[model samples]
Target: MAIKAKNLSFSYRKKKVLENLNFEIKDGEFIAILGPNGAGKTTLLKCILGLLKVEGEILVFGKDPSTCKKILEMISYVPQKSTLSTDLPITVIDVLRMNSKELNEEIIEDFELCDKMKTLFRELSGGFQQRVLIARALMKNPKMILLDEPFNGVDVLSQEKITKILEKVNATVLAVVHNINPIIHAVDRVMLLNRELIAFGKPNDVFTKENLFKAYKAEIPVVICEEGIIHPLYGDQHG
Candidate 1:
């Protein structure tokens, strides 16, 4: 297993953010966490990254993240794009070099960032900045990756590119996404949360209207296309 959480709960300023969360992610599986704002989507990622203290247990590869700090090196985390500053006068290559002295040419090429190496990080579009951050996160060659709101501010083309790249990664992935349209078909499972685990299973099975209403506390449109893909029309931060 890549991650296991049992009765996991977290509180901020004495109010619970996450409560009694229990789930397991298999090796190499891609999981998408969906919920409204203040639903503890990002907090869960922090807990997995061992950035926050919480009740119960969260284990990475069967090791406690809080105790065994070494396991943290095996996991890479990328926060929401809005929280990252792009006004710095650093080049794409310079930003990447911060993580490792030896660069992976294949990754640079695969992300289609070869031509932008010399470009200033601040000059790139929001899509490109997100791509650069994700590429930088992979420099450590981690076994697992955590991404929070990766698609925020990203254009459709960049979203497609990022989704395609994620489909090919060998490591386990857990992404907190505001909209599931970009990767609804690629992810192995979908987790719905609203201070609790509302549903955890395959997208088709877990994305029922009833579950969506329960998690969002409102009726949400759930659509199934001709290809049998489930699409939740109400996947924004409005709540």
Candidate 2:
């Protein structure tokens, strides 16, 4: 297993954020975490990243992430694009170079950032900026990658490209996303949350109307595409 959580729970200022988030993530599995804002989606990611001390246990590849420093080296984390500063005068190459002495030309080309190598990071469009962050996340070639709101400010084209890149990685991926359409086809499973684990299974199994309603506390519509993919029709859920 890439990750295993047992009786996982967390609180902030004495208020519960996540509760009993027991789940197992297989190696190389691509998992998408869906939930409304403040539902502890990002909080869960932090727990897995060992940035928070919760009430239960979380293990990454059989090692306790909270206690094992080496386990952290096997993981890479990408924060939401909105949380990152876009006013920096850094260049794309320089930003990527910060993580590794030798750059991965393949990633720059795959993310279509070759031409923007010399451009000031702050001057790029929202889509390109997100791509840069994701590309930088790959610099370490980690065994597992955690992403928070990767598609938040990305355009359709960039979203598609990002999804493709993520699908090709030979590693475990866990992403927190408010909007799931961008990754619906690529993800192997879905973990719906509402301050708890609403459901965890394949898209077709977990994205039922009832599950969506439970997670969002709203009647979000769900449709099955011709390819038999479960697609949820909703914008960002703020509540």
| Total clashing pairs for each candidate | 0, 0
Candidate lDDT (C-alpha), each: 0.89, 0.89
lDDT of 1 by residue, 8-101 (tens): 9999999999999999999999999999898999999989988899899999899988888998889888888677666778999998887777
True lDDT of residue 239, candidate 2:
31
Candidate 1 — worst ten consecutive residues by lDDT sum? 230-239
Candidate 1: where are CA atoms >4 Å away?
237-239
Which ten contiguous residues of candidate 2 have the minimum total lDDT?
230-239
Cα lDDT tens digits, model 2, 1-239, are 99999999999999999998899999999999988888898999888888899898988899877888788778888898767777878999998986677899999999989899999999999899889888988998889999999987789999999999999998999999888889999999999999999999999999888988888878887778999897888647533
TM-score of each: 0.97, 0.97
